[model samples]
Target: MCFKHDRAVGPLIEFFPRYCIMPAQIISGSETAKAIREEIAAEVARLKTAHGLVPGLVTILVGEDPASQSYVAAKNKTAHALGIHSEQVTLPAATSEAELLGIVADYNRNPAIHGILVQLPLPRHIDEAKVLFAIDPDKDVDGFHPVNVGKMMLGERCFLPCTPHGILELLQRSGTETSGAEVVVVGRSNIVGKPIANLMLQKRAGGNATVTICHTRTRDMAFHTRRADILIVAAGVAKMIKGDQIKEGAVIIDVGVNRIGQTESGKALLAGDVDFDSVVGKAGAITPVPGGVGPMTITMLMKNTLQAAKQAAGIE
Candidate 1:
C-alpha cells in the first residue's frame, strides 16, 4: 500500500520518519527528557547538600492492571534513579474509597512526602473526584487537583499536567517558536488536549500561540490541521490522521500511543494517531511513537515532584 497522500505542498519538513529513509529531524523524546533529568538530578543534589532535603514522591496504586502497574513502576524507578525519595503504596483491587482517601490524608501531613500521585482509573467503587480532591494541592504532583488546575488556567505557578508540560518542553527545547504560531491540537482530553491548548495560550515561552482544538464533533479536521505551524495529534484512534491532513513544514507531535495488534512474531506493536509514514515526509520535526512523548511524561512528573519539594522546604 502506498503511504503518500495526494495533497501536495512546499518542501518537506522531513521530521522523524520511522523505518523510512528520510531526511527529517527526528525529535527524540528520550534525548530531551534525559537532558532535563540531568538538570533535575543536579538540583536534587543541591537540595540534599544545601538543605539536607531529598524530594519525595509517593505513588498510590490500586488493583493489578498490568499497564497501570508498569507505568507506576517506571515512575518509581525513575524517581529513585534521580535520587528522589520514592514510596509505592499498593492496595488491593477491592479497597474502599474511604480507605484510599485516608491514605491521601496521611501523606498530605507527612513532611517527608512532597509529591503524591494516584494512578488513574481507580476501581469503579471509588469516587475519583473525592479521592482527587483529598490530596493536598501542594502535594498533588499529577496536577489533577482542582486547586492546581485552576491555578494553571489563571497562569500561576502550579504543577502542570505532566504530559502537556512535557510536550511544551519538547517544543521549546527543540527550538519551535510557539509565540504567534498557529497551533492545532487534535484531542480534547483534559489530560492532553485541553491543557496543551491552554498552555499554548499562556504568556510564556513555548506559549502565546494561536490554538485550535479539533475533537470528534469537529468538522473539517483536515482544513484546520493544514493551517497549523505546529500540529499535535492526541486522538486515541490509531493512525487516524493521514498525510493528506497535514500541512507541509508543520511540526508533528504524536501523543497517541495505541496497541494496533501483534507483530509477525506475536510481539505487541504500538502506533500513534498520525499515519507517521505518510506524514513523516512533510513534517519538520516529528516525534516517533514509543520514543517521543512517552518518555517526557515521566520526566515532567519528576520536575513537578522537585518543584513540590522546593515549595515545601520554602526554597525560593
Candidate 2:
C-alpha cells in the first residue's frame, strides 16, 4: 500500500506492505529531541536528589570550523537543558599537540567530568588518533577511544558511539525488526560505518542481523542495497541512491549529512545519502534528514553521559 502526505503541488507517496500499515509514528526530530532532553533532565534531578551527583560533560573544540562550532553549541545547549553540567574548551587551530593532550589529561583526572568529547575534524596539524587515545576510556563519551572501540568489537558492554547507538534506538523504538534480517550498511568509516556493522552482527537482542557492508571499493553498491531488508546509507554523498537502487518494502536508514544548493533559491540545504523523494515510494520506511538520525545522536550522547555518571557514583 502507498501512503501520501499532500503538498501544494502534489502528494508525496510512500509505499509499505499492507500488513505494515499501522499508522507509523512520524518520529518528529524536534519533538523527540525535546522529549529526550526532558527525560535526561528528570534523570539528572533524580540522581542529584538521591546521590548528590550531577552528570558532567566536557567538549574540546580545536578549530573554529563552522559546522563543528554549531554542533558543539547544540551539545552545550542540550546538556544545560537537561540540567547536566557542561564545559567547552576552545583551542586555536594551531594549538600544539602537547597542549591538546594536557587539556584531555585535566578532564581525565577531574572526578566531576563524567564524559568528554573532542570534536571531530581536528586541525590538520594535530593527530586525531593520538588525541582520541589520550582521552580516558571511562570519560570518552564520543566512544572513539580505542578501548571502547575494542570493547564494542569484542561484544562487551561499553559506551557506544552516539550515531550508531542512535540508529539502533531509532529502529527499535519504531518497532522495526533486526534479528535475522539482511542489513546492508553502505560506508566503512570507523565512526558510523564499521561500529554499526559490528553491532548489527552481534549475537544479542536487537542484533543478530546478517549484515553486509559496502564502500567505495565495493564492486556494485546497488546490487547490495537492492537486496537489503534494512539499508543504512552513510556514504557522505548527496542522494547517491535512487528509488530503483532499493528494493520494495526495504527500510532505509540514512546516516549521511550533506549540504546541497537549492534549485530555486541557490541556497544550501541539508540532504541525506538516499534520495528521499524517489526512495520513499519504494521503501517500507525511510528516515528523513535533519529529523531522523540527527536527534538520535544527541539523545544517545546523553545516555552515555548518564551511564558514565552512574559508573562514577558506583550506582551502576
Regions more than 4 Å wrong, model 2: 1-30, 262-267
- How displaced is residue 123 in candidate 1, in Å? 0.6
Each candidate: RMSD to true structure?
5.2, 5.1
Local distance difference test, per candidate? 0.91, 0.86
Q: List clashing residue pairs in candidate 2.
A: none
In order of appearance, the predictions have TM-scores of 0.92, 0.90
Give lDDT tens digits, candidate 2, residues 1-316: 4444457313334333343433323435556666667877898999999999999999899888998999999999888888899999999999999999999999999998999999989988889999999999999988889999999999888899999998887778777889999999999999999999999999752678999999989998889999999999999999999988998878889988898866686866899998888887567888888788898888889889999999988896
